[model samples]
Target chain A: MLSGEGPIFLQLAQRVAEDIINGTYAEDAGIPSTHDFAIFYRMSPITSAKGITMLVDQGVLYKKRGIGMFVAPGAREHLLAERRAAFRQQHVAPLLHEAELLGIDRDELADMIKEKDPS
Target chain B: MTTAIDIRGVSRRFGRVTALDDVSIAMPEHSLVGLLGRNGAGKTTLMSIIAGQDRASEGRIAVLGHTPFEHGPTLRQIIYVRDNQRYPDDYRLHHVLRIAPAFAPNWDADVADELVDGLRIPAKTPLKKLSRGQLSSVAIVLGLASRAPVTLLDEPYLGLDVTARSLFHTILLREIAAQPRTIVLSTHLIEESASLLDRVVILDHGKVVVDDETEAARDSVVLLSGNTDAVDRVLSGRPVLESHTMGAMTSVTAAGAADDSLRALADELGVQVARATLQDLVSAHGAETPEPLELKKAIRV
Candidate 1:
């Protein structure tokens, strides 16, 4: 699950954020502890702790004193908003870049997207 | 954080050959540090010195604030399971487990039993008759079950299969979390164990090559490959660790992070730029000529 570019902690943080955005963790629901993440991901406890701490700092996750970490309220919406804001730069830009190199015009790209849209 | 194990200017000599040369490392308590290097890179020698099994020809070592050699109290708090640990003649697995608690103050019988079954260590085979992997499993049982505050595992994964290795990783993470301790594990499997380490100490030719947090060490260099001219231009004057060229294609592992400008240059030049993985870093530093140890001070954390 951690096979990605950049530091492991950053990849872990991004994964948790994606999970939150996908509703895997409901708002205010408790998530696994740092140690749990370490064991599950086969990574060091320090690295897991750093990833969780980053989320806590970003208001995406919150600590409940001795209980454990929980998905902060509105965390899903916050992450969704953030992802949506960067969607073009992170996803569409790459798609368009590859399309241009393949000599595919914007109209053809739009047609391909429409044809692939199942719903 | 308190220092768990401290080595200062430690060097080990085997008659005419030098095993370790003026190596200094201070590992803080509860840190999972990776001691890595090629075979005969003095990994075993350094571990032996730290575990009090052998004395350094020069310098000093402190484990838990006291010298480990012949120091009973300090030695009791540390556990070092050698890769080729020997057992008494005709000793069975049960016999070793029975006597282990006598030496380990924090020994946990439940942990030992769990590991025995989990690793599928044969109960009836004599220790002397066990295969290399079986012997490794026995060592792992002792290492984990001891639960000492300071643990040193020298090549614990030797001869282990893929499934066995994964089980070891799971068990190690769980044990450390339940009972936090300082661990220094030496391994030849770099990428396999890289994720489990928060701190990394790489040695080459008996000298510390890179000592830093795992992520920082991986980011300290960038891998570039493509046309020879494009790669060279992107590298510019940066220090190259290791480089290979085939026909017009050149691949270079260069020191320093791939900054934004460098990335832009690489993109324009159609050269691939990526962060160096832990394995890449280790291999590059391993192949590098032995630079003066003084030059390595800049990479130390």
Candidate 2:
């Protein structure tokens, strides 16, 4: 599923974070070990560990002294808060930038967004 | 990182041709390295020198802190398996199975049996009687089952079909995860085996051109595309690895040209920008690239 989209580990981190948001892994539940992740993805264990480590650093997952990694409490909330903030930069900014380039005013842009809005 | 294999100023000359010229590479222990290069780029020569199959004409090599030459204890811990392995004309697969364990001190007979069965290789068949693909399978079984400290595989999946190649990859990675080791897999099927490598070493004209972590290697190049003049203006200052022009649209692979400034230029000049893959990097580095290989390409041994 990873096709040279930046680094493999960061891509893997994104997938794991997405799983947390989608409720595939419950908060406080232990995620797959690096070996399991490597086997499942058919990649190197070293690569998977890097991704897991990234999550650990981000407070998305916590590691016990000897035990494996577990989903942090409120990880979903943390991720949602992070993604919502990113939504403005990733999805909102491009729309606004294009609207400005096309000379579309504020009300017209809002109207266009509402017309095509899924909600 | 602890170095498992350290080679310095290694050179191998066959007649007038300098197969390996002042090649030096140090592989960290428990790392899977992909040794990649075009034909006659000295990958095989370098592997042979490190594995002690052939001696370097000049320079030094150390495996596990000891020189590997004349099949000593240091060499015993390393297994070199190539796609087209040759055995005595009289030896059969049965004989090889009986004797291979003696060479690999850490050999696992059960793993060998499982892989042989998994690959559906006929153990009763003579070594000379097996087909090319079957021979490749036999080599892979030995390489995996050996579980050696250092494993050198030179396109061991050359003739394997999609399923067989996938099986080899699964078995190889599983074994490594269970017991990490230094493995250098040399192959021309760059993209197919790209993900399996932790570190990648690229050779061109018998020299180590690029050696870096696989992630960092892929991130070093960027693709710029769009109208010819727009893309050209955006790519002007960058070192263009390879570029293609179809009609008025131009696609260029630029090395070390990935930055916010470049992206802004590409956008302002009406060009598109994207990341470059390892395959793109391989073609960009050196050597004339042939037509792009299919997703599933078999290297003929």
**Tens digit of per-residue lDDT, candidate 1, span B225-284:** 998778878988788888776667778788898899999999999999988889999888
Measured by TM-score, how close is model 2 to the native structure? 0.92
What is candidate 2's lDDT per residue for A1-119, written digit by digit as tens?
A: 46646678887899899999999999999998988887777678888899899999999999887898899999999999999999999999998998999999999978877896656
Clash pairs, candidate 2, are none
* Predicted complexes: DockQ each: 0.85, 0.71
Give the number of the best model, judged by lDDT. 1
Cα DockQ of the candidate 2 complex: 0.71
Instruction: List ranges where model 1 is wrong by over 4 Å.
Output: A97-112, A115-119, B288-301
Model 1 Cα RMSD, 1 decimal: 5.0
Which 10 consecutive residues of model 1 chain A have the lowest summed lDDT?
A110-119
**What are the per-model C-alpha RMSD values against the true structure?**
5.0, 5.7
Which CAPRI category fits model 1?
Answer: high
TM-score of chain A as modeled in candidate 2: 0.89
Write model 2 residue lDDT over B1-301, tens digit each, in one string. 9999999998889899898889888899999999988877888888888888899999999999988997588888889975567788787777878899888888888888888888888877778888888888888888889899999998887778888888888888889988899999998788888877899988888888788898788778888889866876776666666777666666877778478888888878889888777787877776453332221123311
Collision pairs in model 1: none
